[model samples]
Target: MSDLFSAAADELAAASAPLADRLRPRSLDEVVGQEHLLGPGRPMRVLVESDKLSSVVLWGPPGTGKTTLARLIAGASSAHLEARSAVTSTVKDVREVLAGAQARLGERGRRTILFLDEVHRFNKAQQDALLPAVETGLVILIGATTENPGFSVNSALLSRSVLFRLEPLSDEALVALARRGLVAEGLFSGGDGTTEEGPDAAAKAEFEEALEVLAVAATGDGRHLLTTLEVAISLARSRHGTGVSGEQIVLGIPDVEGAMGAKAVRYGVD
Candidate 1:
């Protein structure tokens, strides 16, 4: 009975989570895009694999995998991972994390990796509070920001960390990501819910066109792509009529446009 209830709770939590969060890559192999930083012998991969990472800043537009990379770094290393958003955290919070890191290092010799999301939001004083621990190697700081760190971050703190820039994903990458999301969410047709085989050839063609429309509408952000897909699927499901079955609610271009409140535009040169 307890096991059944636990499983039910887990299912409920997963259903409530955002599709983007649910689909976040679990390992470097599963991660799409950012090939330059994650490819063979890349500096980021080397740092994570060797667990010799130093303080670093990841600068990128929203949904470009800054937080994902930071989490990957912590998972690859033996360090205890701590996460905080600079938008909500204060100087006191920084001091607390540093104190905890100091204690862990002194007592258990365990390193702590601090993943500070939106680090550019931190004011100069709050950032200053983190300098001592970062400098002394008590904590490995992985700061992520959509803003330009060089302009938003304190020069002193910026100087202490290596910076990596992440670019917007390409259109092909966005299409692949949307397709993966469709399969993961079990919205795809066919018996297995993974294959694209639909009830008819027309449905399959519509599904493919819908995926393309979503890929273009996403505008290079993986999170946006997945979110749009999720909403489009839900909208399609809600409008199911007598002929429409659960498995027959495959998305179409109209559904994609309706969910996004705009038509898909051409992405690349003809």
Candidate 2:
């Protein structure tokens, strides 16, 4: 990792852990959800690979990995990423991020990606603040919202950006993702731990049951799903007075509570 990214990751690890962070996709290939938009030979892949993508609006319900996708793009494009929250950011804040974009463009001839989370929360005035900058190509806007953009965004702003709808992850996808996360953390038996160098059938079955319950509760939201998995991992490590069983694993109180209290928003990209 670059020095700046390493520092940022360290800070996040030290600070309050957000659901997005817990569930954050390690890479594009590992992304748990949004296959419709990001699967092989998809339009989004074409646009992103072309490196000339226009501003886009990611419309979806909560937990669909909107923030994760934005982060992935920012990392891949080498763009100066500026994130703003429609819930808390004023027009002035938007302007400041826009200014950063302008400066980065001038200095590096690189594109700037402004990821707006909960974009539906922005009223007319706030969205208006983005007009001039967007019109002039100072930044590429990536807006995410749980609500419908037509109801939240101004027509002009909506018109300027391409809209990409992200679907909730399927149950199979969520199950696959949980196993992958466990593998990534070396919780599975494929490396150094108690078992052989691969996930055993029993472990796989345990994860399958746990993931099914999580997926159903998460309601297709990859963020919530992953956060639950993270909580389970910590619980397993701590040996917190209880053991995981098929019944206890699924709908575990700890995982459910952790997912609920987690910082649902990280940088307004979700």
Q: Across residues 1-270, which tens digit of lDDT does each residue of candidate 2 receive? A: 599999998887855665446546667777776767788988777677667768889888887778878877777776778887888999889888887788788888977889998888988889899988888788888999888888878899999999999887798777666665665455652223325343356654544455566666677877666777777766655543356332222223344335456423221122
- lDDT, candidates in the order shown: 0.84, 0.71
lDDT of 1 at 9: 100
Write candidate 1's Cα lDDT for 150-233 as tens digits.
899988888899999998988888878887776776666433445443657876776777777787667778999888888888
Backbone steric clashes in candidate 2, count: 4
26: Cα error in model 1, Å:
0.7
All candidates' TM-scores?
0.88, 0.75
Which residue pairs collide, candidate 2? 63-221, 117-268, 190-197, 190-198
- Residue 207 of model 2 has an lDDT of 42
Model 1 is weakest, by summed lDDT over 10 consecutive residues, at 189-198
* Candidate 2 lDDT: 0.71
Count of backbone clashes for each model?
0, 4
**What global local distance difference test value does model 1 have?**
0.84
